[model samples]
Target: MKISPKKTSLRGLRIFCVAAKYRNYTLAAEELSVTASAVSHQVKTLEDELGLELLTRERRGLRLTEQGARLFRELEPAIANIDGIIAEVQSKTAASQLRVSVQPFFASECFVPVLEDFTARNPGIEIFVDTSDETAERHPVSADASIRLFRQKPTQLESDALFPLRLIAACSPDFLKRYRKGQEFTPLPILVHTSRPEAWNIWSKATGITLPPATSVVRLDSMIAVARAAERGVGAALVPVPLSDNWFKYGALVPMFDEIAELPETFYLAYPKAKAEIAEVKSLRKWVLDLFQE
Candidate 1:
C-alpha cells in the first residue's frame, strides 16, 4: 500500500516523537497535555499507517524497536530544525536573547562573577539563566545551552569542557581550632554532599590518612547547603574549589588539610548539536570558553 501525505499526519509524528523520546506513553501524554490512552492510540495509528513496529514493552518501561530507533534519530533533528525555524519566524527579535541553563554551584561560583563582563562585551545581547537540576539531567535542554558537571560527555549533545572540579576539605574556623590545637587533627564530624558521598574516600586516598567513620554525618543535597553547614560549624565538608573560595577568604571556613583532590568529573557547556550553528549560541559558547581559559 502506498502511503499518502494525508495518511502521515504531522500531529501523529509529533506525538510519536514525544512518546519515543520519553519511552512512556504516560509521560508523553503528560507533556502533550493529553490522556495516556490518547497517546497510545495516536502511536498505534502512526504504526498502522507506516507499517512499522516502533516500540516494544519491557518489564520496566517501553523500548524502541530497531526501526523505531533509526526513525527517531532522523526525525529528532528534523523536528529541531523545524522548531528553530518556527521560533525564528515567530519572534524576529529572539536573536538578541540567549537562554542558558546552568548548575547552581557553577552559576554561583563562576558565571555570576563574570556575567557583568559578558553583558558589557555584548551590550545588545540579553541572557536568561535557569538553574534547575532537571535541566542538567535531560538532553535538548529547554535553553540555548546548559552548563553542568558530568563524569563523561553526553552522547546526545555537543559539549565543551569548562574545567575539572577541584575538591578540598574545609570546616568552620571554630571547628578547626578545637580539633587541630597544635597537633594532628582528628575528625569531630563530617559533612557529606548527598550527590558526592565518595568525597571522604577520595580525600582519604589523597592525604594518605586512614580516616575513621565520622562520629556524626550531616548529609545535604546542594553544594550551597553543604558549604553553609560547614561554615556554621556543622562538620568538615569536602567542597569544590572556587565555589568554597569566598567562605575561606572571608574566614567563615578553613581548609582542614593542605591537600586538594581533583575529581574525574568536569563541568561543560552542552547544547543540542542542531543548534550549534545559531549565531547566539556560537557567541555565548565563545564567551564561556574564553572565561574559563582566563
Candidate 2:
C-alpha cells in the first residue's frame, strides 16, 4: 500500500518511534506528555496509514512487530537528527540572550569587575545578571545558570566547583588595635552573616580560640553587610577570602587572626544538566570555570 503524504501525520510517526523504542504505550505517553490512549491512537493511526502493524501488545508490556522494528530503526535516527537541527537553531537564537543568577556578594566583588571582559569577548550575547540572594540560593528555573555557595555538591544540576570559601576573622584597624591582646582579639561583638549564624563558632573552633562568654552577636543579611559592618568597627566579622580581598587591601578591614576558617561550602557554577551542551550554556560554563576555578 502506498502512503499518502497528505494523510500521514509526522506526529503520529514520531509517536510510533517513541512507542516502538520503549515498547510500551504508557511509557511513550509519559515522555510525550500525552495519555496512553492518545499514544495508542497515534500509533494505530500511523499503522493504518502505512498499512503495517508496528506493535503487538502482550501481557508483560509491549513488543515491536517485525515491520515496526524496521520502521523504528529507520525513523529513530531521522527523528534524532531532526531534533538536533532544531536544537541547534534554537540554541543559536538563545545564544544572543543569557540570564545568570549570582549571589550579591559575588556580583559586587567578583563578577561585575570581570563582566566587561566577557561582554567584550562575546559581544553577540546580551547577558543579564540577577544578583538576588533568593534567586541565587534557590537557582530559579528562569535563570540559565547560577553562581552560589553550596556545602554539598548539587547532584541534580550540572555544576563546576569554582573555589572553596575560606573565611577569615576581620575587623576595622581601630577595632583590631583596641581589641588586640597578646595575639588574641578580646571578645568583642561578632558580626554574623544571617544565613550562616554559626560562622563565628566554626571559626572559633577551627582556630581553637574560644569565643568569650556574653559575646554580642549582630546578625546581618549578607556577606557584604557583614564585611562593611566589620570595616566600620561595628564588630569583628568572618569574611570570605578572595571576595573580600579588596576590603583588606584597601585597609577597610584587617585580619584579626592569621588562621582561616575554610568552610565546607564552596562556590559553584551550576545549570540544568540537559543544557550542558547548549552553545550559550557551554560558553558560560567554560568562561565561568576558567575565570573562577582555583
Candidate 3:
C-alpha cells in the first residue's frame, strides 16, 4: 500500500519520537507541553494512519514494538537534521542575536563573569542567555547553543568539553568551627541538591570519608541554593569546585576536607551540527574555549 503524505504527518512523527524515546506518554506530553491524552491521541492517530501497532502496553508502562523501534531509530536522526536545518535558516535571518541556553549555576559562576568582555568584543551580536535548569535537555531546539552539564558528550549534538566537574564538601566557617576539631570527621547535617541526591555517596567514594547520618537533611532544587544554604550554616553541601571559589575567597564557606570528588559529569558547549559553522555560534564557541583553556 502506498503511503500518502497526509497519512504521515511531521507532528505525529515528532510526538511519536518523543514518546518512543521516553517510553511514557505522560513524559512525552510534559516535554511537548501538551496533555497526556493529547499525546496518546497523536500516537493512536499515527498508528492508525501507518496501519501498525507502534507501542504495546506493558504492565507498568508502554514499550515500543519491533517495527516502532526500527522507525524510531531512523526517524530520530531525520527529525534532528530537519530541526538543525530550520535553526540554520533562522540563524541566517537573525544573525545579530546569539541565543544561548545555559545551566543556572554555570551561567552565574562561569559565563556571567566573562560576559561583559564577550559583549564588548562582539558588539554586533546580541547575546541572549537563557539560564534554565531544563536548557541542557532542550538545547539547539530552544536556543542556538547550550552550555550543559552531562556525564558524557550527548550523541545528538556536536560538543566541546569545557571543564571537568569537581565537587567539594563545604560549609560556613562558623559551621565548620562548630563541628570540626583538627582533622576529626564531623557528623553535620548534609545539604544536598535535589537533582543530585547521590552527591554524598559520590563524594564519600572518592575521598574515603563516610558521611554520618544527619539528624536533619536539607534538600534544595538548585546547586546555587544548596551552596547558599551551606553558607548560611544550615548544613554542609557538596558544590562544584568552580562555583565554590568565590564563597571560599569571601570567607563565606570553608572546605570540609582537602579532597575534592571528581564527578562523572563535565561541562560542555554544544550546538546543532548545522549551526556549528554559523558566525555567531563559532564566535561564542571560540570565546568559551578560550575562557576555559588550561
For each candidate in turn, give its C-alpha RMSD to the true structure in angstroms. Answer: 4.0, 10.3, 2.9
Query: In model 1, which runs have C-alpha deviations exceeding 4 angstroms?
Result: 1-52, 59-62, 87-95, 134-140, 181-183
Per-residue lDDT of model 2, residues 1-294, tens digit only:
978566678789888887886678876776566799999998888888889988998998888888888888898778766755765677766557788889888899999999998888888888999886532224555677889887778765788889998988888999878888876556678777878878878888888877565368788998778888888899988888889999989999998778887888889998866566777778888888888999
Candidate 2 or 3, higher TM-score? 3
Question: Any runs in candidate 3 off by more than 4 Å, and if so which?
Answer: 1-7, 22-37, 59-62, 134-140
Question: lDDT value for candidate 1?
Answer: 0.80
- In terms of lDDT, the poorest run of 10 residues in model 1 is 132-141
Residue 143: error of model 1 in Å?
A: 1.0
* Shift of residue 223 alpha carbon in model 1, Å: 0.5
Of 1 and 3, the candidate ahead on lDDT is 3
Q: What local distance difference test score does each model get?
A: 0.80, 0.80, 0.84
For model 2, the run of ten residues with the poorest summed lDDT: 133-142
Please report the TM-score between candidate 2 and the true structure: 0.68
**lDDT per residue (tens digit) for residues 1-294 in model 3:** 977565489999999998898788877876577898999999999999999999988987899999999999999989888877877787778658888988888888878987999999999999899886543444435577888887878776788988888998899989988887787856778787888888889889999988667868989988889888998999988989876688889899888888999988788888877677788999999998999744
> What is the overall TM-score of model 3 with all chains considered together?
0.87
Alpha-carbon error at 12 in model 1, in Å?
6.4
